[model samples]
Target: MSAHLLTHGIIHSTTDPYAQALLVRDGVIAWLGADDSADRVADPGDERRDLDGAVVVPVFVEPLARPADARDALSRGTAVVTVLAGPEDTGAAPADEDVQTVVYRHADRVDAEAAGVWLPVGTDTDPATLTGLLTASTQAGEQAYLVPDGGADAGPAAQDVALTALRSVAEELGTAALGRVRHRLVVTHSVTAEDRAFLAAAGVSATVVPDADGVLHAPVASLLADAVSVCLGAGPAGDPWAAVRSALSHPDPDERISARSAFAAATRTPLRALPDAPAAGLSVAPRLSVSAPAVFGVWDADAVAVQSPDGRVAAWSTDTRAGTPLLPALDAETALPRWRATWVDGRIAAEDVARDARDGATPA
Candidate 1:
């Protein structure tokens, strides 16, 4: 594999403006320097991609990936952390070997190791059992990602369930391992001061779901006024970007976050669980207009060129690259390899339609 010489592009070793040209070899950024040194740094056989001048950033990461969604995300330079909805969701499949996949399982009767990652047990799961799982995780050096047994409810009933459940976890995870969990403890309706205190002590924070009004302004305001570092919870929409946009422009001053902070909540807030950080140097692109959001599209047309680890220069969503969507709007089901008909294996096998588990499982 030849080293890539990227020139005339705005390069960001840390998303800051101090760097210019960069050399990528074997998928890791091998070197970074000024644009004028291209000749001095060349290996003679290296490839050259001239960046007319676009902004370069790392790849976007999407969490809770469903198997069906992995391929497209990978193609668009997004890596995924997939989940198993339940015992039924355990197992990994023979996936597109080119894509990077990480599988996680929800607590259930099945062994999480069968798939690779172990999620926390539900609130009802016995304390002894919870302790065992957590102890094993820390001993093995895998941090925990959890889904506690209750939802957000500013009301005491929900709080009771959540608090009790969380207490069970805290006792087991202990002070040290508790920090390993994602900071935000998502709730069903609201967060009481009591709930907030416990969460804070555990080195965690809470995010509340708004009431039926579909507005999170009041809850957000309430959370922040307490002098707590807080952010919006992705309500039913399940899209954090939408929530940020809405919460930032909220009419209620109390509920709003500044546009800059809102953007960080959506993009830069690190991944939820962390025994590991995102693979270094991966990046993202924003939408296709000068005034477009800098978070949707994935490349700096003028300054940066993406080189996938596998050596494939995945194309943009549109035909020309000046400013295009990294992923074009299309149906994944019908859109094939531009040559789709040949791979149909005898009409959807009866075996395919009724599988026991989702395909995040590795093949037998």
Candidate 2:
């Protein structure tokens, strides 16, 4: 058993935005609140450390990662990842104890849910079989996902086929039954306005990669405005922050997602896309609250702010009244905040070499 008392840091929790301390015991959060009250819950043997105003937020989740990129993702503070692999490629995925791996296999049809990840429906599946597969998965308490049949080059054609297929399945299942499953769609390209409406009406969650081949392929801001539950996915290379940056810095200001939205897409939103995630059953679903897994990243940033999607509003702000947790200022031209450390299940999994040496501690 181990106990660590982390004090004097910002906890990015909606439950308590002002929480200044967090207590971790046995790889789970035990308590978190103001610094003054933290001592009451602290034990003499607990390892106490002053956070010195660092920002602590839930660890990042890479939805469409490659197995070979797991180590790179982990070092950058992504503890939870969904790796898409072929049936034979499963063995290549990372098996690290500190990393939570969800493996989705690509096949002609929706196979059984794998050990950790949910199986995805292929585009070639017929409507009748697709309906049956989705219905069965829902009935069995698993929400299956669909990988749409299109890429950046397909433009509207790819989305049309996917929507048509899903529409047919929805008609067969009835709207309510289909909604109960809370289906997810992995979109590779931008969708038409009509398709976005259909996605919202069907209650389907969409995961989008903001950029492909150095160009913006999706209008993320427009999708969010239409009430679509959009999450960000960093394919293969596992650089989620890069995706977040691309979402924030789109050339078309009207299509740019805010820093808050972009950050959530890479972190909190991906968890909702996975029902079997480690944090799925937590009381505070998207917060660093007690009884939740101690999965979070500690970073050194000048300040955190709610960035406006509107180009007119200042790119960054430090106003406490924003009612938002402080995050690193995501200036497009500047480097992102320094990743100080990453904690998974209350254990330090990775740390910056320079910071470790400066603090006279061993690098994680």
Clashing pairs counted in every model: 30, 0
Candidate 1 regions exceeding 4 Å error are 112-160, 168-177, 180-184, 187-194, 205-272, 276-297, 300-364
Report the number of the highest-lDDT candidate: 2
Per-residue lDDT value at 38 in model 2 = 95
Candidate 1 on 13-106: residue-level lDDT in tens?
Answer: 4332344566655434556667877668778887775544544433334433445555444334333333334556544432554334555555
- Compute the lDDT of residue 31 as modeled in candidate 1: 61
Clashes of 1: 30
Lowest-scoring 10 consecutive residues by lDDT in candidate 2?
109-118
lDDT of 2: 0.69
List, residue by residue over 1-364, the lDDT tens digit for candidate 2: 7989999887887677678899999888999999999999999899998888788888887766657767566677787776666565635347565777666645433435442333444445465665566666655555666665433334554455556666776676766665666667777666778878878887778877744554456778888899888878764334566677677777777788777788898888878766554345432235688888788888766766656655233522345455666566666655666678888778777778788788775432
